[model samples]
Every structure is written in C-alpha cells, then in structure tokens.
Target chain A: MKEFETVTVFDLLIRYIKDGRIRLDRTRFEGLATYHDPCNYGRRAQKRFGHGFFEEPRWILDQCLENWVDLHPCRENQICCGGGGGALTSGYNEERIYYGRRKMEQIHASGARMMVVPCHSCHGQFNNIKAKYGLPDLSVKYLWELVADCLVWP
Target chain B: MTPENSLRISIENLERTRCAQWPHAQDNCLTCAMCSGACPVAGVDDFDPRKIVRLISMGMTDAAADSRWPWICTMCGKCEQICPMGIEIPDIIRRLRAMRARDKVPGILQDGLANALRTGNNLGLPKEDFVFILEDVAAEIAEEPGFEEFTVPIDKEGAALLTTIHNKLVNTHTDDLKHWWKIFHAAGEDWTVASDNWEGTSWGYFTGDDEAMRVMAGRIVENMRRLKIKTLLWPE
Candidate 1:
C-alpha cells in the first residue's frame, strides 16, 4: 500500500528499528544467506510502478543477518525461479524445474547455505528447486521467517 | 489455388484480423533474436519468441497459437523490455493463451480460475471454513510464548490494513502465515481479513480472461468499500 502510504512489514520493521521500538538479535542466524528477488515484486513491478522493492528486502536481510551475500545478477536482473505466472499450478512440473536451472545455478554459485525469498511463488519454486536439484545443503527461508526469528523482545 | 497462393491468402486474413490488436503488427521486425535470447522459456518445448513473432507477422497465426509455447511462457515481459522494436511479446502471448478454449486450458490453471470466479478463492473455500481456519490458526498462535492475546480480526471494519491471503496458505501450508501474524502482532499493526472473497492471487491474470480478472479484483475493492478500510496490503 505504498501508493496509499500503507507500510509493508519491511517498512514497518525499519520504522521500528529507526524508532528504537524493536531490536533484532543479529547473532541468531550464523549461516550464510542469499536473497532472491521475485519477478512480480521486483522487475515487473518496477517496470509498471516505477519502483521495485530491491532494497527493502536487502535492508531487512542486512538487519537480521550478520553474514549475507547477494545472488549474482540480483534485483531486476535476477532470473525467475520458474514458478510464476501460475506455473506452480499450471501442471508443468518437469518444464518448470527445467526452466529453473539458471536460478539453481545462481544459488549454487552463491555458496550460501540459506536463501531468503520473500514471495510465496518464489518460496515454493526454491523449495522445489532445492529438492529437484538434490541440494539438501541449501535451505529456503521467508523474509518474515528471518525477521521473526531475529526479533529481540524488550 | 496453389499452396503458395493459399498461404498468402491466410496471411492476408491474419493481418486484417490481428493488426489492429497490436499497432506494431505492421512494423517490420529486424528478425533479431533479442526477444528470444532474453526469454527464459525460449528453448523449452522448442518455443522461440522470435519465431512466434515472425510467424504471427507472416500470417501464420495458427502455427503460433496452436503451439504449446504460449502456455509455457511465464509472461515475465522481459522480451518486450529488451525488444528494440518495443514488441509486446507478453501481450501477444496472453492473446494466444486467451484464444485457447476455456476447457482446453491447462487443467490446474483453468480449475483455479474457475474456482476463484465461482467461490472467491482458487481452492473453492467457503466463508465459514475460511474464518474457522483463521480462528484456529490464531488460537494456535495464542498459545505461543508472548502472543497469548493474539487473535485474528475478521471483518473488522475501519481497520487500517485489509490484507488478502494466498489460497495455498489456507489450504496446504497453514503455518506459513504464522510468520506474518507474528510480525503483525509484534508490530502492533491493525489489520483484518475479510470472510468473503479473501483471495489475493488472480488466476484471471494467469489465464488472460479479462472478465474473470475484473470480477476477482472487484471483490477486493468491494471489500474495502464495505469495510471502509482505506489501506490494503495485498501480498500476492
């Protein structure tokens, strides 16, 4: 609801941090992390609305994790996780996994143990990609999952 | 008439039919493979965005439309974004998808669209069932440490945030929502979920059915008006 001045969870969390309302425990997450930019929320929305949420997610990651790396060619240039445009439910399992090869390669190249994906589509896609590629070492976590895990209570 | 003459006649017919739909239809494309090169699904099922454009431009609309390539396209719009001629490849792909008969559409996508249109969610969830799931999830969350007072506000009029839920959260991955709920509780955000028409993702956008899309989107607007909520956090 940025158009109407409504804050996303990311924006609200940043506000909380700025206002000293919430402090995240950075040491809670020790594993290396990488972020995936969902196509709908990142590039397509950028082209349509003149603003993509490339930074907001990274900012959240920066606050919650001590060690994090960017997925290569990230933000607007990031490859699709191959589960968008209803492909998750479109009954094209093999093709969808095949399309995600580039993304899988990116994750493998990032060398991060965990992936931070904000979009539900991307979350599902990454989980399937991890399973399909047999990369049991890589795990996918939602942005909120990281934020909630790192939340420091007063 | 010879096969060559027949092909020319059909090409002319396709030109007359589809030219107005895309104003750039008449523009001469340089046959560059940029669009195909940028497309993620270009080589899948032997799908080539450049070839589709070429076929459509040459009045081979049937060849382009009949191929399974259009359905495989994710409609990412990267092809159009990278096109030198500014060709609307995704739009054209959407049109090809729309040309398929509703029943002939991919089963899951078609059923999801029909379910969203008929029951206000892709999973065909009833209002009571939705509320029950919300309350159930909320009660479970309440038992969590530091969230004993957590409750999912349903149909709370004038709430600052009216959020939509993806059907998968309610259907399969119910606990996935707890992450957001915990954050909302921690943030002290005033948000409510509508009991009816709470679906966020629009399968109409997926299927290219303009009417279904309009109805699905209109439900969100109608909910906002009815509840008098000014802000919406649609996370789909």
Candidate 2:
C-alpha cells in the first residue's frame, strides 16, 4: 500500500462478495455480456496478489453463468476508462475522451451489451464516455449490484 | 540524534510522511504499492500515487501538482483493494483533485462537472422534464410483462430503504431506475424513491468540492430524516 495504512482491496472484494448481501443471476437477461476488467481491478487485485487473489470471485461469475461474460482486451491488459487521475476533475476534455474512446472502441469491438465495473471512479468516467460518445445503449453496472442480483450460495 | 543515525531517522520520517493522510483510509495501501504499480495513468502521465506521496514527503508539490496523473488516475481504488495497507488511494486522489480545483487550473475533461452542477443531472436535462421522464420510464417498466405492479415512486415518504438513483440513471437511463424499483418491489423491501435530493451519485465528489459534496450528502441526510427512513440505501 502506498498511501493509507489498512484494508487491502483483496480483502474488500472478497469480504464484500462473501457478505451474503450480494446476489447474481444467470437467467435475469440474455445477451453475451463482456467483462471490462477495470484497470483498478486488473492491476490492484489480480497482478499485485497473483492469480490466486482473483480466482475465487472471477470463478464465482463462471459459477453463476458460464461463458455469458467475456473479458475484452482481456485481463492484465484492460484499457483505462479515462476518468481517473483527477481527469474527472482535471478538465482535459478532448484528451479524456480520446483516452476513453479507446475503451469505448474496445467494448464496442467485443460487442458486450453490459459491463461490470468494480471501481466507483471508473464507473463515473466510463459512464461519461458513454453519454458524450453516444454509446448510450451499453449499460455499466456495479459489480456488487450484479453479485447481489444472483446470490445462490452462502 | 548522532550523524550516522540522522540519515536513517530522516529516511524513516520521509517514509512516514509519504503515507496517505486521509483519516478514513481503508488500510489497503500500507504495504501495497499495487495501485501505483497497476495504475494505467501512473507512468503514462507520471501520476503514480506511490511516487506522488513520496514526492510530497520530499516537498515535491510543484512536481506533483504539475503531474497530469491526477486526471490520468481514474480514482479506481483498485490499488487499495490489493494493498496490504488497504489505503484508499482513489479517495486521496479525489481530495487532491478538489485541492487542485481551488487553484482554477482547468483541464478539458473536468468540464462535465460544471454541467452536472448547472443541470440537476450531467446530461443537462431540466428537473421537471427529468421527473416526467422517470415516471414515463417507470410506467413503461410496469407495462412490461412480469412487471405489472412496478411503480417508480417519487417523493414518497416513509419507505424502508430510501432509494436513490444516479442522475444519469434518472434523466438518461430511466429504465435502470425501473429495474431497481422492480427489484425493490420484488424483494418486498419498503423502499420509496425520494424526489428531493433524489440523486445519490454526487458529481460534487468528482470535482473535489467538499462544500458541494457536503451539501449533496446533507440533502440525503435531511431527506432521510424528514422521510423517517430506517436506512439510507445509497445505490450510488
């Protein structure tokens, strides 16, 4: 940890997932959804802690619905939503969109109707991109919200 | 205090100074540099939090402030999740953003925040129209098969969960709120959507405006108090 002195991201996602308050459902809707493994989730939890850190929860999605969600540009190499780094606050309009455009293209290329974003900032940035870029049909959902929708186990 | 020990002491002090100063950190960053290491905007625009804190400790605000990393970082908070310290780096960056915002240094990206403040929602939709849009969408959801009883209530008081929606969800994706409302009805939860301070997602958080953020948060608290809600379920 570089800044604060507590609460690993690993612990948060794991505990949050296990909290039993979250649910997921495979049959709620039908469409090949893609997983936009957020930069935060891609780098923070997956690579920092080794594959073992992410195995369980990513597996949880598999358990809920196999092959329904796919990783676009894949994990460990996901695109930045371009809303971070105070960019949401930074005032870099064209560049911010330029960066977000890459991600928009990435998602568009994958053809996923919905994406599960774990981080709050990423969600904000990506949503901004979708609105301004006119890709309004794509839905970005919080990972916990999805988990809460389909909790079949304790 | 000896010369030999002085160097070590200074180094330790520097290390201590670099840790995030947020009182509410989740301890995800203490031993974890994962956020900085994994941050896409870090080296790309030289915005690494690890180095930022280190630089600050070294009296490097000039460099830190000049860094484009703040806008680059995305406030993902992924670093905290991986950090053993569990420090909420994203939160810290947000604070940094607010502080920088005070200086009037403009970036092209942050302009959307202004739109959010100007309009109740970022899409710049009028409030009256937004309300009408929400009702229309809720009615549509109700009309859908298996959603016959769904109602997207506005300003309805005394609901168990004080349901709030994002501004985007309200003005643009009214359907999403319908989904949440349907979910609430299905859960048998005593949730009612609040018309006043109904938006849970705060752009105030995005622009580094504590006063604005407080105002936004206070509105929700006030709404909850007035409505007598048991719990404030901020879906934001």
Candidate 3:
C-alpha cells in the first residue's frame, strides 16, 4: 500500500496545468458558474485525510472559466446535494428530491447557470434536482468536463 | 399515562452497541441541534442527526437502528462538521446502518453492492461489454480531428497512472469518458485503466458493510500490484 500514492483527479489536473502540459481555453465556457463541494472531498477528507480539497477545484476553475462564484457556506459548511451516501440509487426518489430543497435554494440564490461538481454522487443529485425543481436554466458539469471543454490542444 | 405518551428504554441495547466504532461517544452530545440545523435531511421521515445521538445515548439503540432515518441521511458529514461536541454523527449513522441485516438493506443499494462484489463493476457489466464500450468510445473520440488513433490502454503494466471508471460512465454515459481521455491525451500522460475489478464507487461504504468495503478496496490494491501502476486517480 505504501509503495503507491493514491491521489484524486483534482491533483492530476492541477499538476498537468502547473507543468504546462495542458493549457485551458478560458473563453470555452460562459455564463455565471458556481461550485458545489462534495462532502467527502471537503469536510470528511479534512477529518480523515488531514487535508481537505477545498481550494483545488476552485483553482482549476479559475483557469477554465472567467466568471464563477462560490456557493454560500462552501467548503466545510456546504449543504449536501442530498444524493449522497448512495441515495441516488437507494430508490428514494421523492424523498431525495425533497432533501435537495436547500441545495436548490442555494443554487437559485447564487444565480449561477452552471454548477460544477467534483463528485459523481453530487453531480447525479444536482442534475436530478435541477430538473425536478424546474430549473432548466441551470446545467451541471463535472470538474473534469469543464477542464476537458477548456483544453487548448497543441 | 397513555401508551403513546410513555415509552420504555433498555440499557442492554445501548450496552451491546457501546463498543461499536465511532470516533466520539454519544454521551458527549448536548442536544444542541446544531447538527440537525446543518443537516439537509433533518426533517425527512422525522429524522435528524441530534435525534439519532439522543436515541443511542438514552439506551434506545434499537429504536435508532430500526428507524429509516439513517438511510434517509445522505451521510454528507455536515452534521459532524457543525457539531459543537464534535460528535461523529455520520460515523454513528454508519454504525446504525450496519446493524441491519444485509437482506434488509435498501434494494437498489443492496443489489448494486452485491453485483459489485460478484462482478468487477456495480452494474455487473461483462468484461466484453466494458472493453467494447471503451473501444467504441475511443473510436468516437478518434473521429474528432485532434484525437485520431486514440485508444484506451487496458491493464497496461508500469503506467504512471491507473484510473477507475465510474460504472455509470460506461453504462449510460459513455460519452463522458472522453472528457478525461482528452486531457490525458493532450497532456501526454502515461495512464492505463484496469480491465478487471475496475470499479470506482464502493457500494460497501454506502451500505455500511465494512468487510465488503475492505474486499472491494483490496481489489484496487491488487490491481496496482498486478499492473505495477505507480499512481491511482480514483474519481469515485
């Protein structure tokens, strides 16, 4: 276990950008964007892994998009997208959407048309709520999707 | 007193579960409701993080374990994060979830976890289909002007990075795989994906089965050893 290091995609993206292995096209993505902190990567990681990924995603977003905002109570205090803990596949559809009320409110309040999430669970939940809550204007993208879209080839 | 107004608590229930793993003891909670306030699903099915702690501390461990609240909770750790007493609400909830029999676990989660244990992926997608999807997706990416001749290097040894795919990306969202592949190609990073036991999400963690969680995670380590991969990019 000690021979190999386990890192997240965020770390890889950061390293690639820093080393100039990849350059981002900032103009690729438009519209007001905001981030949703996945609890495991944020609060839980802080307690268990000793270092939370609070700033990594934001730093990557900074390079990819020109306009982005932070969700209220981001990082440690961010609200759950309510699709976590395997709830997306837990067969609690109505209750899951109900649980995401606060998250819906947060996105509405942030006025961000695009919400970038780093976790699959959060991405699934945000997509579910965005449709269930009738927020067609809002679209969800994975952090990697943003990076991929903004990649400047050659 | 009416039966509805009065209830009995059993110390034996609490004592049995007292030694279970939780970072902090339930006795430390002050019923401050901070956890409840921070919890997004606090009121769902009459569940709240504070109530779970209170029930466990009051010798109502059975009541706490039997309720649907733990399952309802997303285990997002917001309650634990905001707890003034620093009680591990998520840990306690996970323990509560573990108390139930495996058959009693919610259906979708239970079935998915079982499939993951039996097969390499949660959806139990066959290796042939997995490879077929990868090659097909790569073909699509290659069709794009810049990514001609792109191919997925499966189970290649001595690669610098090994990435695990989220099952959904292969099952329903095959196109999404291109996003990361594009980056890897552009950066010229040496990465390979395992052709077997390559699941990214650990359903055992969600279902509160520690042993299963260990087995699932062990497969990843085994992959690293077999493939001689130096780094893992786990996006799950």
Candidate 4:
C-alpha cells in the first residue's frame, strides 16, 4: 500500500483534464448550462477539508461545454438542491421539493437549459424538481457524465 | 418605561446543551437574518434558522432537537456559509439530530442506514447481484468502438485507486456507471472496486448516526487494508 491518500472523482477529473490524459471537446454540448454545488463537497468540504472544489468543477465544465452560465449565486454561496442530508429518502419529499423552490428559481433565472450536479443525491433531486416544476426542457446531469460525454478518445 | 413582558431563559438547560464542538454557536450571534434568507427551508413549517439559534441559546435545546424543523432542513450549510458570526449551525443541527432516538430518525434514512450496516450497502443489495450488474454494464461499455473488452476490476489487490459506488448507480442509474468507466478507460487508470461494502453514500451521516457512520466508513478502510490499495475515491 502507498500513502493511502483519499480523493474524489472530481479531483481525478481535474487532474486527467489538466494533464491531457482525458481530452474533451468544448462543443460537445449545446445551449446554456449551469452548475449546482452540492453542500457536502462545496461549502462543507471547503470549511472542513480546506479546499471546497468550487472552481475545479467549473473548470471541468468549461472543458466540455461552450455556452454555460452559473447560477445566480454559485460556489460557496450556491443554493443546495434540497435533496441533501438524506432529504431525498427521508419521506419528507413534498417538503423537500418545496424547499427546492429556491433552486428552481435560480435555474429559471439563470436561463440555463441544462444543470450539472456533482453529487448523486442532487442529481436525483434535480430530476424530480424538473418533473414537478414543469421544466420539461431542463436537462440534469452528473458532472462526470458531462465530461464522459465530451471525451475525445484518440 | 420598563419591559412589560419578558421571559426568562433556562440557564441550566442552555449550559447542558452547550457542546465543545461549537462553543460560540450561539454566543456571538448578531441576530442578522442572513441565515434565514440563505436557507431554502426557512419558511416551511414556520421554520427559521434564526429561531433555531434562539431556541438553543435560550436553553430550548431539546425543543430544537425534537422539532420537525431540524429534520426538515437538509443540513445544506448555506446558513452557516452566510452567517456573519461564522456559526457552525449545521454542526449544531447534526448534534441535535444525534440526540433524537434511533427509531425516531426519519424512516427511510433510518432503514437505509441499518441496511448499510448489516449488508455493506444501503439498499442491502447482495454481492452476487452487484457483481452481475458490474459485469453486465462493462460488457455494454466493451461494445463501444474503442473499448473492445472492458472488464470491471473488483477487489483487485494493489490497485492505485479504489472507487466506491453510489447505490443508485447499481439500482436505478446503471448507465451512469459507464461515464466513469469510460473515463477510467481513456485515462488508463488502475482503479478497482471492492466486492463487499462498495457503497459510497453514507446514510448514517444523513441521519446523524455517528456510530453507524463510523462503522460504514471503517468497512471501506477495511477494504483498503485488505486489498492493499493506497488511494480511495469517495465521490459520494
């Protein structure tokens, strides 16, 4: 065993892109897009781990897409998708969706047709919000999935 | 004019509820409503982050703990992020959530946490099915033009990185797994996953069950030690 260092897929993605190990096509995705910051990895991670990863994700998104915009308040100040802290499975789903109204508002205000989330819970919650809020055109994706789609394998 | 009506707070209860983890959680409050404005669930059930702090500072810790407000909150840290005093509101809320009885925890979260402890995954998915899904999905990835024979490495000893799976990836979003696998294939990364205890999400952390969280996290460490893998990619 080596030093036993722990890293998130986000960290690895950043490394792979920067190192040119994984090549991406910026025009892979069309239309405006936005990024949703999961609480644990964004604010909590920054406060506890000393690096919250706000810019790394945006940097990754920038690699794969051209027409992307950030939500009204992103990074540490970004709104949670309202499905974290077990709210998705807590059986308080109605309340959870209600709480996500702020997120929906941000998405609507951003005029983004696609939203990328790094956390699994946020991914699921945003999908549900999309259905409930009648944003049928709104596309939700995992940050890695977006990168995966943009990969230019040689 | 003297104050017509003022309620006295229980100093004893406030002292009892005070914990070392967040010493100034309530002490240095400027009563700014930034937290409430930042919180997504502030208005639900008449919930207010400021009110929760007021309760804790007033020695109504038990009330705050037992109230539906804390459970309603997703512990998103937005309030703490915007707080001028830099109060650890989420930490305090987690402490209060821990004080709740085990059975009293939100039902789905409680059950999922128990399942992860007993079966090494939140959904209690058996090892056989998990492996089958991995192989099946890998086969699909293999059909792609570049990847001729993609095989998922499970419990491969001495691998450089060990990635855990979020249960939903196996249960509902199996296609999502391919995204990472393709990336791994392109990056030529030597990563392996554990056959047992491969779940990445921690429901224990969600339900404020620190003991359960420790157990779940320990299982991953156990896998690392067993496999001799140095790096862990805990994406959840």
The estimated TM-scores of all candidates read: 0.92, 0.61, 0.95, 0.93
lDDT of 1 by residue, B173-197 (tens): 9998897788778777788989999
True lDDT of residue B190, candidate 2: 65
Error of 2 at B96 (Å): 3.2
Instruction: Give a tens-digit lDDT track for model 4, residues A86-113.
Output: 8888788789999888899889898899
Better of 2 and 3 by DockQ: 3
Q: lDDT for every model?
A: 0.81, 0.58, 0.86, 0.85
Among the numbered candidates, top DockQ falls to 3
For model 3 the local lDDT of residue A96 reads 93
Candidate 3 per-residue lDDT over residues A86-112, each given as its tens digit:
888878788899999899899989888
Model 2 bad stretches (over 4 Å): A1-64, A68-81, A84-114, A118-154, B1-37, B46-51, B77-92, B101-127
DockQ, all models = 0.55, 0.19, 0.82, 0.77
lDDT of 4 at B207: 73
Positional deviation of B210 in candidate 1, in angstroms? 2.1
Best model per TM-score: 3
Model 1 chain B lDDT-worst window of ten: B5-14
Over B1-236, each residue of candidate 4 has an lDDT whose tens digit, in order, gives 11221255545535643554565544677789899988888889899988888777666677888888878888889888889888888887888888889899875788888899899998999999999999999999988998985799998999998999999899988998999999999999998999999988888777778888888889899999999997899755
Q: Is candidate 2 or candidate 4 better by lDDT?
A: 4
TM-score of chain A of each: 0.91, 0.72, 0.96, 0.94
> Which of the numbered candidates is closest to the native, going by highest lDDT?
3
- Record all residue pairs in model 1 with backbone atoms less than 3 Å apart, i.e. clashing: none
Q: What is the interface RMSD of each candidate, in Å?
A: 2.2, 7.6, 1.1, 1.3
**What DockQ does candidate 1 score?**
0.55
